[model samples]
Target chain A: MNAATLARTRGSLVGRPRGAGHVLETLAAWALALLWLLPLVYAFWTAFHPTEYSTHFSLSAPWTFDNIVHAWHAAPFARYFVNTVILVTMVLAAQLVLVTLAAYAFARYTFPGRDVAFALVLVQLMIMPDVLIVENYRTISALGLKDTILAIGLPYMASAFGIFLLRQTFKTVPRELDEAARVEGCTPLQTLWKVYVPLARPTYLAYALVSVSYHWNNFLWPLIVTNSVETRPVTVGLQVFSATDQGIDWAIITAATLLSVAPLLLAFLLFQRQFVQSFMRAGIR
Target chain B: MTRSREWLHAWLLLLPACVLLVLFTHFPAVANLWHSFYSTPKGARPARFIGLDNYRALVDDPIFWQALQNNALYALGTIPLSIALALLMAVWVNGRIRGKGFLRLAFFTPTVLPMIAVANIWLFFYTPEYGLIEQVTKGLGFASHNWLGSKSTALACLMVVAVWKEAGFFMIFYVAALQAMSPQLAEAAAIEGASRWYFFRRVTFPLLMPTTLFVLVNAIINAFRLVDHVVVMTRGGPDNATSLLLYYIYEIGFRFWDPAYAAALTMVLLVVLGAVAIAQFVFLERRTHYQ
Candidate 1:
């Protein structure tokens, strides 16, 4: 039988009674979902409403843009936004180029020490740059790139996850495509660009989404490597702002928190399905 | 072209990534070990060889032991519950439930927000008297309590936030795996008159083992690696009750300005992760046989 009929049969057989148990299960799911969303909903509630209503949770609280506006002007958030954009873009761009090249080589070529090299690459997956903060800080300082956007993006540029994902995708490409491109006088790079890259577009998209969200939300390394307002991303900036101005205004703090997360949140909402699917695709391997 | 030329081409292509991976990952890892054997240089005083001194300090440090214990507890607290919740979420979303779309959105929404940002919101939620939890419990006639302030609840509070942030991200993987599953299995189970729970326990759960293993490894790594919430929510405070190993490393290396000691602490984290890596490799190797 087809999938739909099979699904219907399974549903009928499994959910045969469709009585209190099903209702309870549904209630439990919705309740969990609501509980899961409470913090964010509370964030939005506190952000848009007046400060008096932050803890009040009144339904008729007055709404205003004052908190977000105050938050935006409170710090050099515009600069923070610019720095974050540059950092995420720089990291993603470098990752794409480097990972594409490395994955291309690993996927299609056989060479000396290739297994060892691949194993070395995979080592980064476990001992991530996040944990190497101390030595990396020293390295960045030694290279005199400390507190720059480049320093923030540098350590993450050669992402093993990206390379691994792309390598897996590239392996699935038929060898005939490579031969055809070569027979047409295309060089290896050209063959990769024309054949492998085009076919692995889904993987590229998935990796890009995962990488962007990761670096966008990344805190500690940027927090460590950057000390200046000129270099601090929104996460660190928000932390500095909130920590210094501790507990004075929940409205403003929540507003700053919302501001830092707004762009990615909006993107996820707009492309919710794609974002979820991309994460699923990225995680499956 | 020729084999030698092809090798040259491949090496050239791998050059950039290899250089970076070594510089940032491998080199620092080795340097962490090398630095851990020495003393941190003071003004006009260079780092001198002090073999095992830092390691000895690590063994004797109360805070180090506390951080290690907290990290272990944090992992134990977060992993199983999040994975269970993720599987339940994936199953529910994959089922023909009403408003599953909205439920999925709600569940996955937390995965997108920055932990630092949400930590602020949760900080508010855990506020002493006026926080949401406080307000609710007060309505239920409970006394006031500081959720994040108390040493007892601080790490547990952080673990809650970690689970909130991670479960949805992991659910996506399970959802993908569940969708890829053949419906015929369920139909076959149903035709055999097996109960839903029995089918799930016997067939569905076993089938999801690979996904579970994958998620478990990621979860374990994340437990060590994720300090954003700890940094934001607690800063390893309430007498270091919330200090994970990496957070302690950050505190020692940067805040305390003792990279050598921090490197020693980092060696401990590296050993934990290395152990995790080997376990994962063995698990994956064994799993391949099943496939």
Candidate 2:
């Protein structure tokens, strides 16, 4: 400890110590955090305040649901919300099934090019689904999936992160369980379905949450693939709201922005701890 | 009889994802390479093959080169700022305190929300007339400036927003790494009279290298892919001031209907991303060797 901190902790009267470094670091961090969150807080402020006050910040502005109400009537928000849910659910469901099966295979059964194939599979992380927009756009078009909901999701269903996460999680499972299952006449698939999947629940949850957040916020691929209102996800819908040649209205745009973020924000707030842990587990493995 | 069938069944279990990967990812990559040399004729029966001609034109395309430079500048700007902010926040959140969860969640909240959503909202913050930023600035008696309108300021403004959106998510990784550290080392250092700064610099920072490398790769990847903000907020505006490489690719391939040339640009991007991925693996291997 420095003399300042030492003096504070030791209660020295003449040469009083202070936790100067500690206080300085803590203050800087907190200030930087609030500064970092300024835009979010700005959004939050704008979302809650009434229109006409949208451009201006006022401490005592008259608050109303007018912007949200105007925003609700302005677009097919309910439909957009439903579509986002369905899209996230469909993608996550497929990822869970496919990644679990593949992860189990790579983890338990050693096969030819197993390492190479796994490494190749990880190439998806470096080259995102967005990067191959030309090819995915072509691939989706070829699959006769243009402008459909599934077109927006089909490429992402085989998630590299999903597979990698589950593989790591499965590696942590004890070998004895596999042996015991094999001795008990459990086939490999059954051993995987019964023992490994259940054992990797936290990881499953983590990857699922990550995938959902990822796809929910995903816009570019969805933008290129989905065409009309019937299949549009929330982000695309929000984009189309302001993507016009005419002068854009700040109130309506902010309202639409608020609508897009509300659901995931609500979800994050509710599952705050698990949501935080989920990201950590993803990074750790 | 069933023993050999079991091996086949194991392959069967992997078929769904394997097929999807091959069809969507692997084939498209090959096709992107293949299609980069051809132009689809509007009324003709087939695409005209022009080998290396499109790439030759790309080398001379000033717009493409400018966008590429902007992308590099963007990558350089966002990577270090986000990484530094993330580490700083991770240290703060990792400290012994009440409501660390709340603080961490606050920091991470942006990662979960739509980037386009936040970008649309932040657009107002960068707006010129009656925007929040302008209001703040004009209120201070300084002449107001369009934050996203000027070529010089627009890209930097976007980078600030990007780092804000990304840093906290990166911090979670560092926090996890910090928490995973054995507390005994810190206590030993404390007994030997290491201050918090000293403890962090000497003991804590070196130990967090793995997480730092992971965050570095992820941050770079995120910097490239997250053009949703550009699409929503600036749309590569004010003379393509904030035109990033991905957005440039979108403009060239899709907007300009020159997929042949766009594919060449994407090849450049693929090389960049591949290099980073290789560097990450090298970092991992080196760390393992050191351990």
Candidate 3:
């Protein structure tokens, strides 16, 4: 105990002794941060500097916002921005109802084939609808929801991840709470509404945030389902904007790229801690 | 109400999602497996069943071989580097860092951004001239080079970008796992004259085993699932060097409009994913049993 106290006292004076391993580890960490920031750094440099100055990073170089104006004038990013918001909201709204009801069932019921049915739904998690584009396309074409926001949102409405997450949350609610509500002469549905749904509020919020971010970044499904610029999401539009055969204009492309990610970036900046916590609580890696 | 009625209502609630999953996911996977065996002539109605022909054809197909090699290389390259880097970042952020929140936000922001957006940014970074890399290289008097335009370097560049985008997301998981661990263990080790490296490797790392395994499986899966950057940034171009397995499947299924061949290739992918699933369960099962 005395030795422990002595070490604790000296710990602040002499920092953790330098080691080959720690040196390597710190270098590796900085390397990773650099790697993640490489594109952003490049983009920032290009965005600030002119075309001639973009190639050479002299400290006395000139910089301008010509790229931003160029990119802004090239497309109606505002419309794409609104479309993404609508798509995320539409999908999340439908998912809450479908996943909540499905979760309540799995959590509360002891039905035949419950396990198998739940597993079936979860296959969507592994083999996403985007992979089955040929079939999904046929389905969308048949529904006549093609080239519309509804089509972009439809396949994602019944989310397996939401169902699984909600089920886990619902199961944590104590049995006695449900029993008390039922004994108060409430119906089964009424008990669920009063006791269970309210209890699972945090899980609901976490799932909604995850679902919203997911749909906001979703690309391939929206790409295939929508053709017209009027209905396209940010991802599809960005792809088209950047893929000109003449090759990308680095400064303007970075500006456009930054514009595309601005919303989620702002939201995440505002709720960075909560966003990190949500992933932790969700047990997602 | 009664127990039986409650059960019925439960099924009723589950019915809609179950049906949709069945049609879109489960049924399609099964149908894809079936379709892999048949031949549908272009512009014809009836299809002829040819068992093993498609799979055999895939064996001889050079692009299939290239794609398989690329994906295996991709999984091999990205998983260990990113996971190790993620562990490092987590350990650092878990330490007494002054700007942990800001650093975490910077690390994680790319993941929330659409891949296409990131691809565009990286496109500028990999630009033949006037991009940051070329600028830096040329400033130092080295010859400026195209990072993604060449077949030799494109996949490596893609792997680097991929590790960048994903490492933070993985780091967040490890940080949570590390934070949830009691500080007592590390403190005890410090008193015993144990170095920080020893403490981390011997005590902290062992405690984080379950999380490491979890992250490993996820990182492996993401290695396969995410080739969007490849598709957008490189288009698997320059002699198909960056032609990853899934993108090749996309090309076959959507661009080439040959769903049968794509189905066969997807079967191969399913087999690969199944192997990963087995590793996760088997490794975890053995660890638990030993414990």
Q: Whole-model lDDT, candidate 2?
A: 0.81
Docking class of 1: medium
Residue A76's lDDT within candidate 1 is 95
Q: Order of candidates by lDDT, top first?
A: 1, 2, 3
- Candidate of highest TM-score: 1
The best candidate by lDDT is: 1
Give all TM-scores, in the order shown: 0.98, 0.94, 0.91
Ranking by DockQ: 1, 3, 2
lDDT by residue for model 3 over A65-155, one digit each (tens)?
A: 8887888779878788888988888888889888988998999888888898887776666667766666676577887888999988887
What DockQ results for candidate 1?
A: 0.74
Among residues 3 or more apart in sequence or in different chains, the pairs in candidate 1 whose N, CA or C atoms overlap within 3 Å are: none
Candidate 3 structure quality by residue, lDDT tens digits, B1-291: 677886789898988777777767777678788888987567756667999899999999998888888888888898898888788778777664445555676677777777777877777777777667786788799997888988889899888888777788888889888767765665666678776667777877888898889888878777777778877888888788899887888888778878788889888877777687777768988888967
Error of 1 at A257 (Å): 0.7
Write candidate 2's Cα lDDT for A1-285 as tens digits: 786565344322211114775567666766776776677777767767876677666788987777787777777888888888899999989889999998887777756667888887888888877898987887777779899888888888888888888888889899999899999999777888888989999998888888889989899988888888889998888888767624646666676787788888888899888888888888786
- When 2 and 3 are scored with TM-score, the better candidate is 2
Provide candidate 2's TM-score on chain A.
0.89
